[model samples]
Target chain A: MHKIMFVLLCLLSGCAAQHNNIKLANQLQQEPPEKILSILSEKEPDQSDFAQYYLNLGYLQLLSGEFELSIDSLLKAKNEMLSLQATSISENVAAGTVNETFRRYSGYPTDRVMVHNMLALSYLFNNGIDDARVEMLQADVEMKKLAQSDSLNGQLASTHLLSAIIYELLDERSNAFISYQLAEKILKERNISLPRGLKLGLLRMSDKMGNDTQYQYYSKQYPVLSKLKQVRQKKHQVFGLYFDGVVSNKVQQSLAVPSFNGKQIVRVSMPAYTSVQHRDQHNQINDNEQKINSEVVENVDKLVREDLDKEYPSILLLTTTRAIAKYQLVKEAQDKDPILGILANLATIFSEVADLRSWNMLPATIQFSYLETDADHIVVSTNHQGDSVVELAALKQHVILSTGLSDKVFHYEQ
Target chain B: MKIQSSFWLAIVASVILSACSTSVERLDAQQQIDLSGAWNDTDSQLVAREMIEDSLSRAWISKFVKSEGKDPAVIVGRVKNLSHEHINTNTFIANMERELINSGEVQFVASSANRQEIRDERADQDLNASEATRKEMGQEYGADFMMQGQINTIIDVDGSTQVRFYQVNLELISIKDNRKVWIGEKKIKKLVKNSKLRG
Candidate 1:
């Protein structure tokens, strides 16, 4: 019995090579994106954890201005996610016997949606407009499927806004209008205010499509529609996206209760989110004629917290069941042999670690701004990263993507 | 007894290693192998063949030939991929070009990128090649029609099962008159059911 307990302890220890994602998240806040990207590139993640690994690596690659590499990594991550969607009997058994971390990380619904969103942006940065449009269509399908499953799981306003921008760039005004409306609906559903760019896009598309009813309705709500005339007269339309500070990390929370008449401890471990105070950076675009301040389009911090809250009950039940089973095993061993009981208790305590893996490299908030101008170039600035001069092509539309965590700025024009 | 136990362990280890080892088998290029049920070369080649055949059989080709009194010249245009997958439309276009050129019924001209390269080569010939062998510019055939199309897909996924439907639409438009002379379409549907467990 003692030898069996020793072998079990060795197996659990071998499987307990947990990644310190919290430390990596902290490093991402302090270090430059390129340095962190190189570090991530050097580290080989476990085979089952490739989804989470590639998600972080792809986002970092995007921030580091490796658009092609970013697209490749994001695609691999997407494939990994798709393959992991199926229920794995062996993983389930391991999870029940050992810990939840033994199972593969089959990304959350929000992560799935964001993967397509990031892929769209990466394709855009690589000047593949058609590919970007394809990503938008895929994102729409994913969001629809997620909505059918649960209304709130994949209602990401940023994705819709990005889709609207891509559609408008492709000269599909009708689709653009629908995307803007979808973004508005999601924001309204979440009780989040609509960004300025979304409002302007809706009004512009509605007017262009000759939807008098929608135009009139929005005109009454936001008098800013009156400026649509002047905006339409401009020769260029510029859209800017800002990715703010790093998202919060998931930490392990442990609860130990004395059971079996205070002889053994039943330890329940769970993944939790500690409240993190992120810096609120002001972002904007300047075309020398007017200054447009970006507004929050998606609050990833809030979305991640809500996702964890929804999964809390299931995680709690699993942890409790495992804890009870471990306690019973300990009691049975003690009834037979005291040394074996001690060994079993030690193994149980050491193996009861929470699964703390997540796509923690995401931005805290995604912000957006729209500008209509005839200027040849625009200066985009954030309170954290200094100003970047973006030379607009002679095209009618352009998209400028920047992140507060990096100095790089990616531009897509049409 | 110890030798027997060691021999059985070795046999078991060999079996496990063989199971885990990678194996490769060469197969014919035309053989259809469906894995993951996404778009593949087989779909591209088969779609191109069927669509080009349908286009060639239409009345537009004979009408253009009879009116012009010669084989009508054609050029390939952009084939946009609007599907969810990152499909290389280049291969599909190449397949179509090969079929149209090999059919010998219509004249296929260089595409825009190829036209530029040929023009550059001709200019270089003027600079370096012998006078008789030098190719002249401004004498290239101008295509009467341009072929363009887009690939679109509709995917429905439930749990581990997915139904993917792809639609490809191609059009041949008169370069001078801006009239659509020929329209072609091809579709493919696949159902994929993933295993619920991994070993």
Candidate 2:
């Protein structure tokens, strides 16, 4: 009986491994990105959690300006996510018997699409335009697949806008127009107001593609399309992307119910998000005469919350069943011996933890702004950092990516 | 009780040791081995071989040879990879070059990078080497046609099953007239099913 209790305790201890992940999430907010990256890089790959590991590592590497390494890590994460799409019987059994964390961290729907988005950015930063185009097409395929499964879960406006930008850069005006249209449709479906940059892109692509009716509709509605058209031939264009603060970390919520005539305690644990306060901050880009503030394109916090909400019912059912099963085991042990019952109850209490694992290193919101200028460079500044100059040189198009966590700015030109 | 403990301990030890061990095997390179079902060497080689074969048999090569009174010089240009995978287009281009050169029907010139290196070597010889052995710069043959292409793929995934369709398109364009003299296309489709259980 004692041996059985010891084995159960050991298994429950294994379920508590996510405490380290929670600690790491806390560390991400305090430590420098390079230090955190070094720590994550030193970790050996956990086969079951490999996707989550690489996902976090890749994002940090991207923030640290390691474009090539980030691309490699993100690709590995993508491949692992693909392979893990198949249901694992053993992992399912572990999930049912132990805790939800025992199951592999096969990415959520948002993660699947974001993986391709990040890969596209990584390729663009590395000056691999053709590879970036491939990632955008893959993102489109991923979004379509996600739409087939769940109508509203995987549609990301940032991905579509980025795809449109890449297509326009490649001189594929027709594809660029389609992508811009898709981005607009997604924003409309989600009830998110279209940003000026996206609106301008639609207007420009529509006018270029000879869609007079749609162009006229937007021009009438926005009234700024005329001004945008006037500056269309500005010799150089700059697009600014700002990744906001880290996304919220998931915390465990436990509910205990007395059962078996108030003798046995049944505990149900589920993952939940705590409200974050700094959700509205954004970065600003400035030239000598004008200042452009990035508009929120994707609120990653809301996407994560929506993803969790969609799966809440199933999670509740499974967690309730597991809790009841665990309570019954404790009751049986008590009927046999009081000592065994006490030990089993202790194990249950320790092991009944929610799966708090997530790709927590992602930004809370992704913002975008566009500027068409004939100038050589522009100044970008955030609340936490001073102004930084981004040189455009003679490039016809340029992209600037910055994150709130660091002052480092990554740029690419074409 | 002791026997049971020993037996369990042996089982755990064996499992750990087995997992820690690594194994290696060698086989013929030409043998087709599909793992993860993404694009591989076999697909690259087969596509290059068949596409080049089709391009060489077309009327463009015979017409060029008859009109020019010699085998037309060819240069391999950029073969863009626009697929989901990071395919090494260089290997595919090299395979096509090998096939074209081995056919004994066309002349193959060095690519841009290789030509630059060769030009540098000739310039070095002009300054440092004896004049009797120096190679002239302007005597090099200009390519009559350039081979350029792109690889594209469409993947459809359902549950544990995925169907990958790859389309490779190659075109030979006349350098002087900018006319596409020949176009060759090869398509490959694969159906992959992944197992749902792990040991």
Candidate 3:
């Protein structure tokens, strides 16, 4: 009765969590950008919907002149968006969609583009002219191709408007003039009214170009563009949520076993948890950042030096080791098994660690990340010899997560 | 025999426990971070390092000396994204820029992001030059070469077992010559699966 009650309680909690997630998603979907952003910031949830919520909220923030907050929310969604390929943080990042958007990362693109365009426009809108210019060029070249084929013409025209703004920033009056003209043309052709505040910039731009006729045309149309050059230069803010543990492949698994024509038997398994400990030993890893957790790092260090050497000795076979571990686990009812999905997430965590350490040592970019503990289940198995002449402990099984990268065929040169 | 065996068992168990406890060290914990170096891939990093080294070795560039010459040339054209994974080319190019500046090979156009940052930080003008002065520096030291590239992957599977492949291709094109001064490619591959554990 007690066991049944416990099981029932667990189910009830899971359902409640699910319910909350649906409510949150519905709430974010309906709210205005400011309200959406406020809600996203107020609560941190681990579900994909929450991350998506933040991404949408961030986009709205960018629209409403809250660049710093937009940058913050976008960065938050990015860190949480697990699948790699889909997240477009930038259009240039998205152009690789055909070949680059791996099946695992596909979920990220929709949300990815929201922040990407916002950042681009924010930079362009506020007058980070060159940054905006490159972003616009990249958007015009990379994203426009995709957006045009799709039914998002208004956004596409807006992208062009931002690009024109970039040209204006560089004092490249010609390019700016042409782009603005194109934007105006796009608005008219698409049958979309010129957004209320947009005409003033066109007027200002025409006046700068000394095109009296064009200037007169725009001057006659109340130019609402404010003279203040906006700079979406707010520093990103980060709030620590859950430190969700993730597993992924350490490097592109490329150590292929040479096929022995007939004699040698080769064995393989799904894949092993990339030992994160190996990332720092041989080459210099840039970990000289000022802030970091000491205890956790020390634990990682110990695991690298000792556990990795024992389990994955140089030139070792992951299959044999995991098999032995699995057999041991089964004998003792240990739940962690290679078949269970866990190793991949662990490898991804290590990869993120390696990437983070290296990313920090460079020239400063407006970047921030927060670490918080979420949840993870660790499975373990033990094995004992059943009826052997010599007493020997057999194996141990553990769960590992295989990054989705493992399944998809990657081909660059065909 | 049982007593001796139990004692040995305890020793082994203790060793195993201790070993597992300290499995990460110099291998897991990095000493310092140089985010400047591209975190994209090891093989690609090596290739860029070598190509930049090669460029620096050239006699013309080796001899050219400048007190504060920055801003090189613009990128010649688009770089193909060849790899299966979408890698941000900026991650790698940014490193190349730092190396160029460090070696004093060439300069880069101040990305508006960086330019804006500089201006914001130095709002107090007497301590630093104004925005106009900085923009002038960008023109004085224009870029000479543009770096771009792609990443690709390959996989071969025999029944359930498989072999995976990865390659990153990069090229440094000279704006003046329109010539591909340097092209570098790096490949990585892995094998997975075994029937030994089949039920």
TM-score per candidate: 0.94, 0.94, 0.33
Best model number under lDDT: 1
Give the alpha carbon lDDT tens digit for every residue of B1-199 in model 2: 9999999999999999999999889989899999989899999889988998898889998888788899999999999887877788989999999999998889999999998999999999989989889898888889999999999898997766779999999999999999999988899999988897654
TM-score, cand. 3 vs. native: 0.33
**Tens-place lDDT digits, model 1, residues A310-347:** 88898888887788788888999999998888778877
Which is the winner by DockQ between candidate 1 and candidate 2?
1
**Which ranges of candidate 3 are over 4 A from the true structure?**
A1-39, A56-69, A76-112, A121-138, A148-155, A172-182, A195-414, B1-199
lDDT of 3 by residue, A1-414 (tens): 354346445434433433543454345323433564455456554342445445545655553566667667655655554233332344322212111111122222223332444555445434443444444543443333234443332134444554554455456777677776776665675465564324545665677777888877776565333332122321211111010111121222322232243211122322133444322111010112212111111112222222223334321343344333433333333244433313322221121111000000000111111211111211111111111111112211110111111111111000
lDDT of each: 0.86, 0.85, 0.40
Model 3, residue A389: what's the lDDT?
17
lDDT of 3: 0.40
**What are the DockQ scores of the candidates, in order?**
0.64, 0.59, 0.03
